[model samples]
Target: MSGNTGYAEIATFFRRQIADGTLAPGDSMPTQKQVRQQFGASITTVNRAFQMLKAEGLTAARVGQGTTVAERPRVAATATARLRRISRTGRAYGPKERSVDHQARLLSCADPDVAAELDIELHDEVLVRSRVYMKGNVRTIASFSFINPRGWAAVPESLSPEPLERFWQEDYKERTGRTTVKLPERRGARLAYPYELAMLKVDAPPNAAVPVLVLLNTWHDEDGPLEHWQDVFAPGLWDSDEE
Candidate 1:
C-alpha cells in the first residue's frame, strides 16, 4: 500500500472471487487484519478497500456479523425504484447516508448520444445533473441525468441540489396541462469510457475492459422522451449484464 499500486489489491482480489462465484452473497469476508496480513496491505488500505465495496453495495457489515457479500439489489436496476425513491424521499442519498457529492447545471447538449436519447436536436439547451456517490474516499457511482427541451421548458427543478421530482411533475402539468409518465426502463451496460473512469476514479477490472456497470433509463410522455438517465456503477460493483 505504499502507493496506488497495491492500495486496491484487496478489492481486486475479492472482486474476482465475487465475479467467478467463488464468493457468494452472504459469504463472510476475511477480517481486515487477516486481509492485511495475507496481502501485506496496510490496515488503512484494507479499510479503504472495504469502504469502497460497501459504498458500491457489494458488502455489508452488521453488528456481530462482520462483513459479508451483499445481496444484489435485484430491482435497483429498474428506473421505477429510483423514481419512487426520489419522489417519496425527495432526495437521492439517505438522510443518514454520508458523503454524497452532487452537482447540477443547465447546459447545452454536446453529446450526440445524450441528444438522441432525449429526442432533441444537438446543441439544444438541456438540464444536466451529475452525482458522485461516495463512501470514504472512493466514488461508488457516477450518475448523469438529462432532460430535453420540452421537459426543461416546464421548468422542472431537475437541477436543484435536492430531489424535486414532484416539482417537475407539477410544473410540467401546469405548463402543458398534460401528465407525463415514465416508460419501463431500458437497461444496457458496457466498459467505461476514459472520461467515465476519470470521473468515477476507479480502476478497470483485472484483464478486462468492462469497468463500469451502466444502466440506461428514459422517461417519456405522449410526445417523446422527457428525460434520460445514465448511471455508471464503479468497477466490481454490479456482477450481471442482464437487461
Candidate 2:
C-alpha cells in the first residue's frame, strides 16, 4: 500500500482478520517489527495501524504485557448513532431546550492522564456532564465533558443536563445579547493519555493513538469574554463517513 494508504489499511487489515476469525480475542498480534517486515512499512505506519486497532477496541497495550487482543470488540458508532454526543468545545448543533440543575455536583476524579497536564484542584470546580448515546436499542457511545469553571458557571443553571445544541439557544442569549452561536471548523484532537483513553472507552493495539475532535467555545457575556471550554468525543465512531 502507498504511504497515504498506510493508516487506513493498517486499520482495515486487522479488522478483516477479526471478521474472518483469524485473530480472536486474547490472541497476540504480530509485533510492530514483524508487521513492518511483512508489509515493508515504517515504524510510524505500523503505529498508525496499531492506533486504528486500538480505536476499534481490537487490542490493548501494557508495558510488560506488550500489545494483546481486547476481550471485546469496540462498537463502531454510526453518524446517526451520535445524536446525544456532547461537544465540550462550545459549538451548537441546533436550537432546542431542556431543564437542568444549577449547582450540579461536578466532580473531578483522579486520573493520571490529566493529572500532570492540569491542576486537578482547578478541575474540581469545572462542570461535569455525562451521557450515553445510542442508536435504536444499542448503545453507540458514552461521553463526559469538563468545562472551565469560570465560563461554565455563567451558563443558566436551568439547562444543566441538556445537549449543547439545545442548551445554547438561551445559553447564548443569556451570555451575549446575540442569539447566534457560531463556531469555527474543527481541528481534531486526540485525548492525551491512557487514563483518558479509558475514560473515552477506547481500545487499540500497542502504540495505538487516539484521534478525537475537541471543540472549544468562548461564551460571551455581554461586555466581554468568558473562559468557557467544553470537550466532546466518541472514541471509535464515524471513521470513513460511510455511516
Candidate 3:
C-alpha cells in the first residue's frame, strides 16, 4: 500500500510474482474489481496493472472466464527477448533490438507480391527501405520494408532501437499528432534464398540451405492498407535474443 501503485508498477509486481512461480501458471488472478478493492486503488489503476501483465504475456482474460494467469513465458537473452521466443515459437512479437546502420543503402522496391499485399494503387508513390544487418563485423541479416507513400508520408529520418510496436506507437504519435496509431492486423513471412544467404554472409548448412527468414508485413489504418513490406534475416539470428 505504501509502495508504488502505478499501472506499470503493478504490472511489474504481478510479473515478478508470476516469474518467481508464486502465482502458478494457469491460476486465475483477482478480478479487476477485486484487485482495486484489495489495493485501495481505482478500477482504472487495477486494469492498467492487468494490461501490464498482459503486455508481458503473464495473464489472460476471457469474456466469461474472467482473468487468469498465463502460462509462464520463457526468458531468453539477446537483443529482443520476445522476438527470440517468437522465432522459436512463431507467436506474434514486437519489433525491438533492431538498430539502423547509417552505412546501409536504401533499395528500390521491386517485389510484385509485396505491392499486391499492400493494395498500393498503380503508379502510387511508395517508400522502399532496405538494410543489411551485421553483428559487429559479421553480416547477420537483410531487411526490406515497403510502405505506402501516404501512410509513411511523414516517415522520420530514423527509428528508435525499440521493438516495432513501441516504435510505431511513438512514431504515429509524432507523425499524425494523434495518440491513436493503427498497426497491421495480419502478417506473413517465409525463409530466405541463395541471394539472401550471400547478403548475410553465412553459409547455409544442409538443412539450412534456405536463406534464413523472408518476412511479409502489412500495416492498416481505420480506412485501409498503410503498408505491405518484406524482410529477410538470417535464420536463428533472433533465436538467442530478447527484449
Report lDDT (CA) for all predictions.
Answer: 0.67, 0.49, 0.53
TM-score of each model, in listed order = 0.56, 0.36, 0.44
lDDT of 2 by residue, 85-183 (tens): 233223221112122222234666354333322334533544556554443333334344444444454565623565454553366466745543333
Sort by lDDT, best first: what order?
1, 3, 2
User: Which structure among the candidates has the greatest TM-score?
Assistant: 1
Which residue pairs clash within candidate 1? none
* lDDT tens per residue, model 1, 138-187: 56567787877777666746657665545365687778887777666665
lDDT of 2: 0.49
lDDT score at residue 232, model 1, on the 0-100 scale: 83
Per-residue lDDT, model 1, residue 92, is: 41
Give model 1 RMSD, 1 decimal: 13.9
Q: How close is candidate 1 to the true structure, as a TM-score?
A: 0.56
State which candidate, 2 or 3, has the greater lDDT: 3
Candidate 2 positional error at 52, Å: 28
Residue 210 shift from truth in candidate 1, angstroms: 4.7
Count clashes in each candidate, considering only residues at least 3 apart in sequence or on different chains. Answer: 0, 10, 12
Give the number of the best model, judged by lDDT.
1
